[model samples]
Target: MSPAFSVLMPVYAGDDPSHLEAALRSVVDQSVRPDEIVIVEDGPLTDALSDVLDSYERAQGDHFSRYRLRENVGIGNALRVGVRRCEHELVARMDADDISVPDRFERQLAVFERRPDVDVVGGYIAEFDDDPDDCFACRIVPTNHTSIAARARFRNPMNHITVMARRRAILEAGNYRDFLGMEDYDLWVRMLSNEATFANVPSVLAKARIDRDYGQRGGLSVTKAEVRLQRSFYRSGFIDAPILLYNLLTRASVRLLPKRIRGRLITRYTRTPG
Candidate 1:
């Protein structure tokens, strides 16, 4: 018998309507179908989104569950609520804007079974240029826990959307917390502190939606990341001086460097053979 998996997803009030359906389809079409799908409607969603989710849930009937939040409690809270409501021993997280490949669950489940020491697993991601016309970026994560955590101080190895974790380990780590913008980062640190192991599957598991207007490399998101990185380093007491200096230099050169070039430099330096 295929092991049951629960997918916990949080959808904000203003998510792209089309993207939501694509996300839902990705899960429904997974090679190893999930036993339950929990969509936490974070805060009161838009009427259009609500209607769409309602229609989708009705179509699935008892195959899925939708947990609607009366008030906006942020992603961490929504995820916590979703986790509590899940019945399966394995929990996979899906983002409302990303598309999971059909074999993602099957591959992740195999990893979990093979590596009993690993408490969580994630995989490579194919990032699509959010532009209606052009393709932009794609990347893969390290497939080993030590390698991933070795670089964790610089950047997160696991894509939030592609994470699958053991329910017991997650609960023992105190689950997700309210960390403003870096909730996932905070949780990963906590899990590591608990000696919970993590790994990444070598295969591409999901497609991330990224656009020029997304402003991840520049603008407010970058600023938020800078603050969050400093805060995480302070809290973890594990940030390396070399990595810190390298990150600062990249941030300073953001305006002078091309996006792809800067991205490559950062990714390379952080994930360099160490």
Candidate 2:
């Protein structure tokens, strides 16, 4: 049986209203329409933002279900709140700023259909900038269970916002939690520990905005979050000391490399569509 889908998006204070419209449109325009669209306004959104959302909702008709958060909460908390309100068995994540391809939902659905045992499915992403020449290619996670678990002990393979997770499996893994900066990684580790399998679609399913503004918090926050994830996995008995130490060192080394080199590598790896 094909599982119904709930597309969940959490809106933060700094989101671009125009961008939000495009993101929402992608969901509404999906090849396989979701059963519900759950928008969680993380806090009191700006008037302009609210107006845009209002317009989008009116246009979407009965396709969407919106909610407003009376008090400001962090992204992790916002996501948890939104997911709880989902009425479907499959939860698809959409970021306020990212753009999903029109076929994103359809492609993800196919993956789930092919691998009924898989609990989550995501895909590759392309990084874009204002300058066309500055784009890079990246994969969110591995496309099969073997590779997924091979790299699972270290870094996050799936982009949280680009994933479609089995609702029941997510609940069994304890759902989203307040992991501060590394909520996605924390959740992935917990899911892995529970023996949940993950896979990514081979095609690029979305575009991720990666710019200078993203790492502003000294990048220490992300690093710290990874450490917390490591602690979680260690405590869960999923990984021992040697493997954890190796992953930490390897991940740190990759981050230490220059951005120019990283960008070049990423660009070189991805093929330009004809």
Candidate 3:
């Protein structure tokens, strides 16, 4: 039997209305539908985005729970608030612009049932641009707990949007924090430090939207945040000093690259032919 879980998603004013509708539909259409979807409005949303949410609420009824924040507090805080509102002990993170495969929740639930020690389960993601039907690239990560722990020393081993984790474990690990562009990585580092088990399903169970502006979101500010996270990990003994230095330099270099060059590098290193 599939373990019941709640989907936690944070939406901001900037999200594309059409994408939000598709994302919500994907979750509602899951093979093992979530018990509830706790959506936190980071702040006031555009009329179109609000309309989309209202329509889902009407269609989904009690399965959709919406919360609002008076001001935008960013993704980390938004998710932190949403997590607390989740009714189920198992909480699945879903981005407002991403689409999960029909069996995504079912597969992750099976992992929890088979491996009681596992606190978090994620999977590979197929990245698409303009059309969801045409996914061009896949982002694969380490599949086992050991590999995931090792990979965490250098980079985020889990895809945030593809993760389903125990709510208690997340809260115990200090929950989400404002980590700039690396909130998920920051949480994973803390969770690993606290000995929370992690794994990936080794299959593409989600589709991420990576439009043209995706690569442009990173720059010096994001690089600084990455360096800060690495340093924190090293100090917390999650990563060694050498690994910290290596990440700082490498991440900074990538952030300093020309936008076009960085975009190409990101695509080349992060994605494989789907």
Best by TM-score: 3
Q: Tell me each candidate's TM-score.
A: 0.83, 0.86, 0.97
Model 2: per-residue lDDT, tens digit, 52-94? Answer: 7899788777767788889888888988888888998899998
Higher TM-score: candidate 1 or 3?
Answer: 3
Candidate 2 at residue 108, lDDT? 90
Candidate 3's C-alpha runs over 4 A off are: none
Question: CA shift at 63, candidate 2, in angstroms?
Answer: 2.7
What is the alpha-carbon lDDT of model 1 when measured against the actual structure?
Answer: 0.78
Q: Which candidate do you rate higher for TM-score, 1 or 2? A: 2
Whose lDDT is greatest here?
Answer: 3
lDDT of 3: 0.89
Give the deviation of candidate 3 from the true structure as CA RMSD: 1.3
Evaluated at residue 267, the lDDT of candidate 3 is 77
* Rank ordering of all candidates by lDDT, starting from the highest: 3, 1, 2
